[model samples]
Target chain A: MKSILLATTTFREAVRDRVFGLVAAFGLLLVLSTVIISPLTVGARGKIVTDIGLASISLFSLLMVLFVGSGMVHKEIDRRTIMTILSKPISRLDYLLGKYLGLWATLFVMMAAMTLIFACACALTEAEWKPTYLVALGMALCEMTVVTAVVVFFSSFTTPVLTSLFTLATFIVGHAIGDLERFAMVTGSAGMERAADISRFVLPNLDLFNVRNAVVHDLPVHSEHVVWAVVYALLYSAVLLAISDLLFRRREFK
Target chain B: MMTVLELRSVSKSYRSDFLFRRMPALTDVTFDVAAGETFAYLGHNGAGKTTTIKSLLGLIRVDAGNIRVFGHAPGTMAAKRRLGYLPENPYFYDHLTAREFLHLAARLNDMNRSDAKHRADQLLALVKMDHKANVRLRNFSKGMLQRVGLAQALIGDPELLVLDEPMGGLDPVGRYEVRRILEELKSRGKTLFMSSHILADVETLADRAAILNGGTLRRLVDLHELGHQERIMDLKFTQLSEAMVGELVRRGYPVERRAEAHHVLVEEHFAMAGLIDELVRSGSRLLRAAPHRVSLEEIFLREVERDVGQTPEDLLHRTVDELVGATSVKEESTP
Candidate 1:
């Protein structure tokens, strides 16, 4: 029960963080700007809007995960507040899970709000409001799950700066994972091959969850793909949070 | 009485960045805090006071030994349900109003919507922050933050209260209010285990205290024994003759003659009437007489200084031996 209250508190705290407000405003503006620029893209107005809208969700949501998630534990420790909270009957896992869910909730709200505006702009252009917006939103959520996991994992042992860098690096590699593998094969470098393989496994293939293209082109969406991506996200996030919980369990706040 | 909390042979160390080195923070420390007792865990800066509190709260795991709160492991759900904690230099979500934060805590403690609201109101009033309940925590002073933290800790009405430097940022009035609140809780039979550098506050509030140094429990100062019932008197009289001073000395009063007065030290067992009667009978004018009581700070500092190298268990063993000896003496006399 306390865990539930704690999760709510965590959500509120993350929501009010200055970074959240900044990203929300930025996303709102970026998605809104897509309306003015959509017609300039000639025959690709729908694609442009979808691209801008998806990019806004991806970028702003990642910002929230990286900035807010990395600082969750460190801020508590630095302010000596962890002592007060942890000294209660709450377990480390409860604290970690509560925080993860809290940030996820904030991301959900922010993404949903931005998607509404994105949809409105697309609808204004005689582009039908396809049900595929749900697909894009789902994929966006999956993207954040992986990003939040990476943030939580790095936050356990490293400083916020390092965690941000590592998470951002993972985001980049997760996107270009296919290219890295193909490059490794062509170069015939065993070390590079191993590095690429490890990167592919370690970094989530965010592109797999990139359903924006499917949404834009009006392609038939795969329910199996959604299930696989969701399962992958859940498994990946659980691993990251598990490692985070392990790290937090051993942290001595003095 | 059930032990509200206990740490058995607990040892904790931090791994150093410099390879293979572990800095021991607490070493084989063992103690039990009885239900409703205000046990003070004391130490200087860098002492294991915070470390011990952290371990008991399960903020950090001990390398060896075990700790139980309410008969359950420290980090377990059941154990946490009965606990409330106040950290030193508390920081809350600055954007949230005080009420919001406490409401959040109450909700987490599993209170229903209406119940959480009521508890939040009650706690804020208890902490004397009812007026500031709706104010954002960002604008609060340090004392306000500490008070809010106190309110938050009590959100669940925890059976076991753990306070880490609760008085750190409080002003004199705030400290007094906190002390009053603690006294109220103590009277209601709630256990409080706290660590603080504020020796005077600890002396005034704590029943028994354990001192920590260099990540070790050095000694537990028994407040009752160290508190003497004797009152020493500092006397000043105008032009007191030698005969009057001699009369005081004859009545078994230790007298030290200063520039124009005499100092009389009174032991607890010494009846004051005989000396007062004798002084009046001798016709010596009593200009001034003031009683001085033994302070807990002095005893705390003395024991802390004297037991510098002793482990926490060593001090506990010594106290146990003294108790055994005293009990046996009572038993022998009874026969």
Candidate 2:
């Protein structure tokens, strides 16, 4: 119940920030630019429009999470705002979960708004409307779910600058884990393969959400894959949130 | 009276950034605030007052000892639900308006929507911020922000209020307003545990106070008893002959000459009788004989200065111990 209030507060704050507005407006322009740039590509104009539009959505949403979410918890601690809230009946878990949900809500809004602009750009560029575009955007939102959780995890225990770097590294490592495992397998390097094996349990498989290529190219993606990918995102986020709670519970907000 | 807040030999230490050396923030601090009393937690900068407040509020884990609010552990929801905290120089969400911030705080405390709004409205008016309820906190002045901070702290209307430096960083008018609001809260039987360097305000509002110095509890002062213990008297005289002045000095009273007035310091009330008899025999004109009471500032400074007068060896040993991370067992302070 408190988490919803916190979520609305977080969403309101993000909406009120001029930076959020500026970035959002810029994101809209970037998505619509697919119209101007779709003619530049030699191949299918519709495919180019879809690719650029989807990439814009992914990039802008990740940027918002990195820039804003990294500072979410730490800002409260630094400013001593959490002092009053925590001094109330709110548990550390509730506070953490509230902050987590709040940040995710903000991410959800950013993704939704970008998706809306992407859809409009699709119509403006005469690109065929397909459900895959929605799926591609939804997968990006899932990826953002992981990224949002990662930022909160790091921000719970560290500074904003470090949180951003660590979250970005987590995102990069999560996406490259698959290739890293393949490379280790091809070389038959026991140590590297072992590292990759352990990473599967530790790092998120963000590749599960990378359906932009298959989505834009009209490839087959089973409904089960989408369902399982969302499940994986939720489960992975829960693990990260639980660890974050443990760390946060023991924190001294001095 | 029921004990609303209790700290039993609480201690805390923070590790230094460079050497990871143990820097003690609080040591063997023990005090309890009774119901319907305003207890002042007094300390200078870096004197562990905030550490103690945070310990009581469960914002930080104390290295040793225990703290309870309403008989529940500090961090437990049972304890928290009974207390409200207003930190020094509270920095809330700048983007949030005064009403929005209070609404969130109310909801966090499990208040329903109608109750939250109603409480927000009441608290805003209580803090005299109803006129600026819609103003963003980022645009508020320091004193205005403090007013909002106080209102939010009272959102739950808890049984106890833990205010750290509530009067700090405020102008004279701001201080007056805050003190007035605190007085009203006190009138309603709310227990207040506050820390302030303003001794006048402490003396005005606090029923009792505990002074912390050098990470240790220095003294637990009862203001009522302190005021009663001051027995010195100041006797002012005019038109006293030089011989009378000489005789009075010989009789052991120090006379201070201020323009036309001769002031005599009477050490005790028993001595004042003899001095007055002598003055009457000498036909000295008595202007006024006023009782001299020691101010809290004087007491506070004396206590803090006593702690500052450590021997060179004690200082060197403490520094080395801090550098080497040595644990020294501390005992409870005697009042």
Candidate 3:
């Protein structure tokens, strides 16, 4: 119950940032840019518009995770407000979960707004809504769930500059899980392969959540795939949050 | 009396730099706040006053000590539920209005919406913030924030209220208002463990106080005891002859012979009666006799400047013994 309260307040607070609004506006501009796509070839035009719109929604949400989500914990500590909140009957775990859920709410709103814009863009560009868009958008929120957890995890221990750097690095590595494996094999080093192997078990395969191509081509995305992706998102986010709670639990607010 | 808050051998150390050298923030601090008493935690800057309060509320873990609130370990849910806390230079969720913030605090205390709203209304009015209920906290002045902060601390109406520098940023009016609210809380049988460098307000509200110096417990002063301590009688009288004046000065009273009236400073109340009798017998007209009480400010300064090199164990035992003695004194003195 307390976690939900923290989440609501956090959502309200994050939404007040101008960076959040402008990022959404920029994503809209990117989505609406697809409206001017050449319509002579409907199949090619649909694929192009779908590709651009889904990516725009994904980009917008990631940006929200990057700028706004990274500061949730730090802001409270910097302002010394966490002293009162934690001094109350709330546990550190509850506080961390509230922060994660709060960012999720903000991302959900941003994704919803971007998806609505993408839908209009899809309609305008003759790239009619396939049920796949929801799957693709759902997967996008899922991917950001893991990424938001990453932001939250980093924000738990470090400054914003270091958090942003580490989160951006993690985002790159998460998406390149395939490349990491290939490089692990191509390089004949045993230690590199072992490290890659460990990361494979630890880092979320964010690549799996990218059904945008299948989504853009109007291909059928199996329900089992979405379910597994969600399972992965939930489990990965849990691990990150657990580790975050461990770090934050020991933190002394000096 | 029930012990509402207890800290035994509490110490905290911080990492100073990349070198990771440890600097003690609180060293062997020991004190207990009894239920229904306003216990002032006094110190100069860097004297670990906030560190001690944080340890009490479990905001920070102490390195080598134990703290309990209402018999529960510090920062436990059981502990937290029984107490409210306001930190130094309080900055709440500025994004929330005064009303919304109060509601949030109430809900966090596990109140349902309707109850939270009802309680928030009472608190808003109690803090005299009803007119600005909808006004955002970011728009509030420092004093306004302190007022609302106090009201928020009262939201749960917990058994104990731990406040850090509650009157630090307030104007005189704000200070008086907060002091009055704290006095009311005390009258209602609430335990208040407040930390402050501001001595004047502590003098008015605290029943007993513990002073810290360089992160060490230097003195635990029963203001009742401290108030009576070193109390002097300033006696004004007509000058006596040289022989009588020599007798008075030789007897250890400080006699200042002014042009119109002479003054004799009697060091103790027991000494005053005899000195006055002697002056009357010696053909001196007594003009006035006023009692001067030593303030907490003076004691606080002396405490911080005094080098207390006792070990943590010694400080702990001394605190417990002094507490027992003070309790007996209080019991004996109370009508």
Candidate 4:
């Protein structure tokens, strides 16, 4: 119940933020620009539009998480607002979970708005409306859940600038973990292989959620694969949140 | 009769890595606030007043010792449920309207929707913020923000309030309103643990006050006792001879001479009857005699001054030297 209140408040605050408004406006413009830019693709105009639209939504969501989500805890601590909230009967774990869930709520709104704009652009174009588009978007949202957790995890102990850099690096490395593992298999170096193995285990495989290419290119994406990706994202996010809670628990807000 | 808050030998130090220096913010600080009492945690800046308050609220962990709120460890939810804390320079979500903020606070305390709204409304009215309830806090003045902060602190209907500089950033009227609110809370049997440099407000509101200096507990005073003027007596005399004045001065009474009146300040423990007889014998006409009690401000200053006799510059230099020495020792032992 407390988490819901906190999440509602966070969502309200985020939606009212001028920065969120600006980012959402920019995202819509970029998504709509796909229509104008699709004619220049020379071929596969519909595919290009769908691909760009999906990628634009993903990119904007990442930007939102990186810029706004990373500051969730840092802003509270900097402004000393956490003192009042935490002084209540709320536990630190509840506070952290509330903040994480709040950012996710905010992301959900941003995604819904951007997805609406993307869908409209897709409808206006010659692209076929595939139910797979929603699946791809659902996966994108799941990927953002992981990104939000990563950003919030860094936010628990660091400044927003460092949190952003760290989360962005994590996001990049997370998406490339599969490639790193594959490279490790082909490489003859033992040390490189061990490092790759560690990276694959430690980092979230964000690539598991990247079904935009399959959906865009009209390729098959199994429902079982989607379910596994959802489970993986949730479990990874839970681990990150737990670590964040531990770090936040030990932190002194001096 | 019940202790609402207690701290025993609580200590905390902030360590800076740049110099390897650990600056102790609180040391052996101990005090308690009783139920239905207004206890003022009095100190100047850097006197560990805020540190102690934060320690009580579990915002910062003490390096040593224990703090209990209502007999439960301060970090426990059971204790927090009974306590409300207003931090120094209270900040809120600027995007949230005052009503929204209060509602959120109410809900966080587990109030149902209707109850939360009703309580929020009551608090807003109590704080005289109902008119601006829909206004975002970013538009609030410091005084307004303080009032709203107090309102939220009270929204939980907490049994105890831990306020750090509650009257800070308030105008005279705002301060008076807050004082009234505190007095009302006291009338209803709410315990208050507040830290403030405003000794006048502390004097007006505190039942007991604990003074801290140099990160140590200097003294804890019962205002009821200190409020009694009988401790010190002021005697006024007319037509007092210089010889009598000299004699009184020699006898250790604080004598002050005006153009036509001589005043002798006497401690209650001294023989006032003998002094009066001496004054009559000296053919001096007695004008008036009255008792004067010390103010909280005077006592606070005296306590701080007594802790460090030298000038502030000298004290600062000594502190720096000690920190450097401590840091050097720490670095040497690190290996």
* DockQ comparisons of all candidates to the true complex: 0.47, 0.78, 0.64, 0.79
Off by over 4 Å in 2: A22-32, B230-257, B262-291, B310-335
Looking at candidate 4 chain B, the ten consecutive residues that score lowest on lDDT are: B323-332
Tens-digit lDDT string for candidate 4 (B1-335): 99888889999999967997999999988887889999998888989888788788788999999888889987789998998888888889989999999999998888999999999999999989999999999899988989999998998999999888999999998899999999999999999989998888998899999999989999998888874733767788998876766666454455655567866666667788888888988899888888756667656766787765675433332333332232221122223
Candidate 2, residues A66-105, lDDT tens digits: the string is 8888888888898898988889887888888888888788
lDDT of 1 by residue, A1-254 (tens): 55556667778777666555855575556656665786577777767767777777778788778878888878877887666666655677787787778778888887887777767767776456777778878988998988887887887778888988988998988999888888999999999899898988778888888877777778877899999999999999998888888887776665
Order by DockQ, highest first: 4, 2, 3, 1
The number of the candidate with the highest DockQ is: 4
Which residue pairs in candidate 2 have backbone atoms (N, alpha carbon, C) closer than 3 angstroms, thus clashing?
A: none
lDDT per residue as tens, model 3, B5-104: 8889988999999999999999988888889999999888888888888888787889998887899998999999999988888898877899999999
Model 2: per-residue Cα lDDT over B1-335, one tens digit each? 89998889888999978888999999898888899999998889999988888888888999999888899888898998888899999998888999999989999888999999999999999888999999999999888888888898898898899898898778998899999989999999999999998888999999998888888998888998774565667788888777777665554455656678776667564668877877867878889988766566655665676756775334433432343343321101111
The per-candidate TM-score of the B chain, in the order shown, comes to: 0.73, 0.80, 0.78, 0.83
Clashing residue pairs in candidate 4 (N, C-alpha, C atoms within 3 angstroms): none
Q: All models: lDDT?
A: 0.77, 0.83, 0.82, 0.83
Q: Taking the tens digit of each residue's C-alpha lDDT, what string does model 4 give over A100-128?
A: 89889988878888777777776787767
lDDT of 1: 0.77
TM-scores of the candidates are 0.79, 0.88, 0.86, 0.88
Better of 1 and 2 by lDDT: 2
